[model samples]
Target chain A: MGIVNVKKDNFEDVVLKSKEKVLVDFNADWCGPCRMLRPILDEIASERSNVKIVSINIDDEEDLAMKYGVSSIPCLVLFDGGKEVNRSVGLIPKDAVIEFIGE
Target chain B: MYDIIIVGAGPSGLTAAIYGRRANKKVLVLEALSYGGQIINTLKIENYPAAPNISGFDFATTLYNQVKDLGTDIKFEKVIEIKDGIEKEVITTKGSYKSKTIILATGCENRKLGIDREEELIGRGVSYCATCDGGFYKDKDVAVVGGGNTALEDALYLCDVANKVYLIHRRDEFRGEEGLVDKLKEKNNIEFVYNSNVTKLNGDDKLSSVIVTDKEGNDKEIMISGLFIAVGKIPENENFRKLINLDDSGYIIAPENCHTNVEGIFVCGDARVKEVRQLVTAASDGAISATEAIRYINERK
Candidate 1:
């Protein structure tokens, strides 16, 4: 499992500037379901260092939520050059993320 | 000049073509751009009967192809203006196209954010339709600003799709449907904040969060990933402002089915006032307008 921690401070540089693919996991710890999905994302991040994985706490970073129109939790946006290319919502199996990245 | 010319290629326009061509009329569909109007932006449509989960883009494409199969002619040109009289003509950027009957199906565009960076993130993080992009935000937090029935309804819909939903309003009260508000409060995932205004969006790439100030002039930051703005939608009736009769909210007014004040002109879809503006209803309106236009053409010619 390869997962990298993405903070609010370095969200842009990691998601937009990185040569590798970027995946943003919009979530918070308080959410019970979010907890179930966090580890899945973490594993994907570690397995694939080429992609940047970031977990966001909606409680502290409301700005990011509104920017992407993240009306739902567990929204994962796959980006390749700062531009959003693909996205998935709700909780699914860890294999789903792996299938998405295809590393 | 064709026997029937319908403006707009959305559900209404394409549906009209299906009926008009079946009536043996020379149906000419003059679309402003490619086939499929704003419906292409929609992600999913559950309310459409028999179609458990049809996407807006796919459904639009299918509808367009269906019209084509019926031998309805299509043109990719934007119609600028229309002149109504004993002879009806539509003015486009290239040249004018005249027809005995015209069915106006030009739909409405969503009211803009009017903010600086809001336009930059239209499809990136900023969106208007939940059925289209809701799945992309599974365990993420999102905020919705507005105080109408649509706003509250959006908050409720997002609750099932999104992780957290923040309901923000500029006024102390909300003006949504009574039953919907009661239904929204029952959900534990929703957070209601009153007298709050969204001042700015803060994020370099996608969206990190938003900066909002409460009524008391206190600043607070709400962190979330998706933002759904259900404030209000503006009708695109500027081109037809002088051509037809409009309601108070600037929507085209049809008397009964698709009949306008003009002799050979008709309208359908979101541009006209109706109870619902779903794909089915738009298609229904298109059919009605085409029938009306075909009959009028037969009588006039």
Candidate 2:
């Protein structure tokens, strides 16, 4: 499955209410690390079928970023259900990303 | 076994890979985090000889591709331990590999404030990279702590986006370039807080204010929506402390030749003790370390 670009409209259904484990990437266009992370996330999305990957542009959705207290870009928050289970800040490698999701 | 196994795929390690492969040696680069190291977060790299005005991401990607095209094997596994012997064993989080020579290029990481609730406040009010998190504090008051080039650069960048910027340093003088300090002085929105250190972080859910203690032990509170900490960097050489010699600050004790105390193990980049830790110097170290490793391998053969 392809990575999902989430906004306020589908954030609830695509991330919070999803049956599968979700990895929501909080990012911005101007962020260099966020740009570096895009291809890696795409690779993960293509390889993994059990987990759902989504990207949320904080600039477009300020309210959602604030609600999640994500002051940092390229922040990866893993959601098992409707709640945030684990999070990793800043840019990380593909293996680290997989380990994060597995944990 | 591979001829060389480079730990960390930053500029230094990647450059070493290019050199190692060009010499027809089998090379493998194991990186814990993403390739490119700290340079990826940088917006623009003005210095670095011919690569002027190039974005850090572009530079890193080009170099990464160059290394890949050279037939160097790059793995995304964090090196956990290194067993020193004739054939060095490099152990990572996932698995292990044996090599004739090893290059320790594990770079440094952001130094934390070590203040109360600082860890919990990350992504709420505390940030390490201004370029990545400055947008969140747009038009909001922010404070940057540190006296190095990174801190000065962060303050300058934040001044454009933040309503007000407080550049706080523990010393009266800044260790960054004079040109950067001059540029910061011209910004009306940037305030220099010297001879002071952030002693406490205030707020429950998020940061609201920080208490700074001056040289005279006077405590003052500065209200801000964000705090960008760029004090300095700490070397990632703790894993190899048992196998290599490190200086007082934990940087690998390697001279300009990038030769570690161990016979075949070499160190390079920000992980090594150096006077100047710039991108160009890192590339220089990469070349030197690779050449040294090649010579060592040939002599043993």
Candidate 3:
């Protein structure tokens, strides 16, 4: 499946209440690195059948960004069982992203 | 298993892919960021041979297309770790794969100023790359921190876009070439802030001003909409620390010939510890590393 666009209303059902692990990408349109990172995230979503990939626009979701302490673009936060298990900042390679997700 | 898994799609990694694929070996290139590496940030590249004068963006695009047409697989993935064995295992954020040899070409990233709110202000007016985000501050005041070639180049590039550019350097003397320094001095809108460090960033939602401190403990607040940090670059080799040897500065310890501590693992580009880190050198290293990798695979067979 393709990546899901996450927002305030579906934050609970899409991310927090999901059965499988969820990867939340905090990004914005103007962020250059974030734009570069989009295709990579989509590739990951296509490869992983069980993991759910979602993106939250920081400009539109300032409250959620503040709640997660997201100060940077292209930030990937991994959630498992409704809790944050891991996260990474800046532009990184795919292997690094998988390692950040843990085994 | 595949023949080679090249990490990073910069000039070096792409160059290596060209060689590896031509040799009829199965090759895959994994890149974390954009395919161009640091060269994409450069506006013009005259030093690269045969190119005469070409924009870095065009150069990178041309090279990338060449590699793509060669049937070499290029994947955009963040590499998490590498496991060295008879068949090396490359673990990425997307998935894991095994290859007979691995070539590391992951380049360096911009160094941070280490000031408070610096990390928190990224994209919110604090940027390390001028070419990527300079347009956001068009006709607005901005500051660049560094005395090196990168910093000087950034300031000169911003002079045409930003209304005013503040070049902040900790030393009175610049480390860049004299030619560029002279050109920077000629710009009327560019102001040099020497012998000072950007100690603080002031703004709640975004960066509004910066407090630069001199060696004598004096601080001056400069109003600006953006801060371009070009102090220097550091190798992003933390992931391969377990599989390869690194220097004190975290650079992969491959003094020469792209030979790493591991038998089948090779390193190239800016990530390796070397005296010179340039586009040509990186491309040369890629050629050498791929050649050596091909030799290793043939010998094993």
Candidate 4:
């Protein structure tokens, strides 16, 4: 499956209630580095079956971003069993994502 | 195991991929961020031999395309650790790859403006890369801190985008090229803040101003939306420090050649100990390290 674009409406079902591990990417449309990171995250989403990749636009879901304490764009927060296991800030490579998810 | 695993996709790493692929080795390049590295932020590179005054983006694209044509596999990943042995295990954030030889070209990160709330307000209003975040401050005031070519270039680039640009430096004299300094001086919106340093970043949730202190210990707060820290960079060798010998400043100690303390692991570019760090020198190191790595692999075979 491809990466999922998340919003406030269905975030509870798709992320909090999901069975598999979730990788939530917090980003904005105007962020240049965030744009660069999109394709890389998509590539990872395509390759990984154990983990689910999703993106939450901070502009659209400001409350979700504030709850997560994401001070930077392109922030990746890994959640397992409905809890945050790890998080990374800034635009890091794919290996970092794998490492962040404890894979 | 593959023949070679090159870390980083900067000028040095990309150059290595070109050389390694030509030698008929299965080369894999793992990059932490974008393929272009720091040069992608550079506006114009005037001295990159035979390609005078070429844009950094164009130069990196050409090199990346050349490496792709040669069949060198490029992976975007952040390498977390390296297990050295007969067959090296290069562990990244995403996955692990084994290779006979490893090229450690993982480059440097922008030196932070270590001050209050600076780290906390990274994307809010404080940024290190002008090219990446300059658009956000369009028609707004921004301050760039540093005395190097990158600082001067950032100021020049921001002059076109931001309504006002403050070039903040600790010393009165700039270490950047005379041409760039002159160009920055010509920009109508650019203001020079000589012999001063940014003491603190002021604002909550978002940066609204910065406290700049001069030589006389006088503090002046400048109201600006963005603060671009262009103050050079530090080697990003924290992850591989356990397996490699590094200098006091955290640069990989490759003294003369690219060969590290490990037999099969070699380092090149700004990540390694060196007197000068430039685009041309980084490419040169890439060629040298790839050649040395190739020889090592050949002798083993």
Candidate 5:
């Protein structure tokens, strides 16, 4: 599956309640690095069937951003069993992202 | 082995790829992060010739595509080390490759504000690129630290979104353009804190305030939701230090011809020690370095 856009209303069901490990990308529309990271995440989403990918637009979901302590764009947080196990900030290559997710 | 292995996907490296491909030589471009490098953060690139008012992202994307269409192999990998010899070996985090020639255009990264808890506070309240994180501080107070064009631009960009912006610089006079400084002076929401430095970052989970100390040693605490650091950039040439000679500032010590101390290894872009580090000059270095690399390979044969 492709990257799922997670909003406040569906964030819990789409991200927190998912059975597989989810990689939540905290991003914004105006951010250049965030836009650059989209294609890499899309590739990951397609290749890794066991994992899930979701994106949160901080502009629309300000409360969710605050709740997650996200103060940067392109912040990737890996969630396993509905808990954030690992997180990486800023733009990184695909191999580094895969290494960050421990896949 | 590839004819040319360019280490960096910025304007200089991408431009080198274009030149190398046009010469009908196998070229591989390795980049650790996203393409475009620091230029991607720039909102408007007015200085680049013929591309007036074009966004930096657009220029970089076009160049990237142009190189891609030419069949230049671009890999996203972090270069850890390089072995210099007749056949140079370029090692990356993922894998390694051998090339007849290598172009080191790694470029520069944001210089950090060396205060306590600065690294820990990243993404919490501190950011290097205002264009990337300024949106998070909408209607909230923020501070910018630097005295260059980037600092002034960040202040101007943040002034429109944040409730208030405090521009703190170590020197009283800004090193940025007079026009940009003048533009910043006109903003009512932007306040200038001259001859000062950020001494401390104050917050637990996130940043709430910063301690700014002036030349007189007087400390002033500025309450803000975010701090954008535009102090300038430092070269990422540590990995290549053993293979190449670097100046005190860690920039590759190369001549105007872009040839390094080691043969078959050329340096270009912001990574090289030069006075003017603009887009045009970088592209110019790319062409010169690629041409030199092509000549070197032909002479070897």
Candidate 6:
């Protein structure tokens, strides 16, 4: 479908596993770079459901962040089978993400 | 009508007022508590470029005087709520007030321990701010919880006065900068206990000790005269909840220019979500909000 708003309630089911690879973007609405990076993420998510793009707001689920060892944003983590396989911190080009998912 | 009204008079609010007033806007600042907000409790602020060594209280006083000299209208009263109209308005606990545009610079409050007796024991012994109360524990043993930048910074600040400081954290590694970790370790008075959480506070009328649970689920009591909880903070967005679109963390959703969903309403500082929650960054947000607020007010006119 589309990007699912991940919360403490459903973080496990969505980010953990699905038929497709998941890319989780941990960001805050007030962050300037997060705004700049939003459209790129939306574009990528719209193109490929094989790669689910989920944005996590640390302010909402601080405990989930503590569990994930996230100290900074915008942090992008890739998950498969309930485990984080890769992660990148700060903002990057959309092409970089496209390459990340091997698209 | 005034061009802008900035709520809260902390660094962000004051700085925003300065820019707004300088931009030729008739600005009024509404403050609930004392003007400086949390800065009054700060002992020293070495980071705000140019002034290498300045007490937060003194620096804030200087800012206060500067804004006042510029003829900024300041009202010392709590803002109960904000009414968003064609032009946003802010109502105080005292009376009703209106503005052409409003900037929300209200900062965050320290998160409480949430444990029983913590509130009753507050001021008696338990505290969240080290700079505010660390002086009382001079030459005595004290405890600081959390591993964030604030926690580490407070622990380091307490190291100067307290004879011994016990820095407790649930993680072995700190979430703060590496340089700070090294600095705190150099202090002979600082001792670190990793993979542990604060369970409870054991105290009498004045001050006493604390109970901590290790990662292994073992809990133990340690004798101490003071306890400081620097774990973290939650944004003070409850007041403006109905007026703005706050994300899950209760932080107001301000765009890149600090403009919220409602017209003529802007949010800055700790009340909004941000990647870096440093003092300098908050000051920058204030500056940005002012420039953008001018443009916003002008566009509507």
- Model 1, B1-301: lDDT tens digits are 7788899988889999999999999888887545667666545677778886776656876888889999988886778999986768888876788788889888877675666687655545566656445555777898888888768877888899888989989997788888998999899899987898888887775767888889789988999777777787777778888979999988899955889888788999888888777778888898888888888888866
Classify candidate 5 by CAPRI docking class.
Answer: medium
Give stretches of model 6 more than 4 Å off.
A1-103, B186-190
Tell me the lDDT of model 1 at A95. 56
**Model 4 in CAPRI terms: which quality?**
incorrect
User: In candidate 4, what are the lDDT values of residues A1-103, reduced to their tens digit?
Assistant: 7988999888889999999999999987656457657888888888889999999988789789867765467778888988998777677766666788776
Please give me the DockQ of candidate 2 compared with the native complex: 0.72
Q: Where in model 5 is the C-alpha error above 4 Å?
A: none
What TM-score goes with each of the models? 0.68, 0.93, 0.75, 0.73, 0.94, 0.70
lDDT of 1 by residue, A41-87 (tens): 77666667677777777657777776766645657888888888877
Of candidates 6 and 4, the better by DockQ: 4
Minimal lDDT window, size 10, model 2 chain B: B234-243
lDDT of each: 0.77, 0.91, 0.88, 0.86, 0.91, 0.80
Q: Which of the two, 3 or 6, has more lDDT?
A: 3
User: For each candidate, what's the DockQ?
Assistant: 0.04, 0.72, 0.14, 0.21, 0.70, 0.01
Report the error of model 6 at residue A2, Å: 68
Q: What tens-digit string does per-residue lDDT give for candidate 4 at B1-301?
A: 7899999999999998888999999999998778878786555788888998777767877888999999998887778999988999999877899999999998888888778787778878888877766766769999999998888988998999999999899999999899999888788998899899899887866889998999999999999988899888898888887889999889999965799999988888999999889898999999989999999999999
Instruction: Name the candidate, 2 or 6, with the larger TM-score value.
Output: 2
lDDT of 5 at B108: 89
**Superior candidate under DockQ, 1 versus 2:** 2
lDDT of 5 by residue, A26-101 (tens): 9876677887888899998998998999999888999999899898988999998889998888888787788988
In model 2, the Cα lDDT at residue B259 comes to 94
Candidate 4 clashes between residue pairs 3 or more apart in a chain or in different chains: A94-B77, A95-B77, A95-B93, A95-B94, A96-B93, A99-B93
Report residue B156 deviation for candidate 6 (angstroms): 3.1
Compose the digit string of candidate 5's lDDT tens values, residues B124-227: 99999887788888899999999999899899999999999999999999999999999988999999999999999999978999999999999999999899
- Residue A93 Cα positional deviation in candidate 2, in Å, after optimal superposition: 3.7
lDDT string, candidate 2, A5-57, tens digits: 89998999999899999999998876778888999999999999999999999
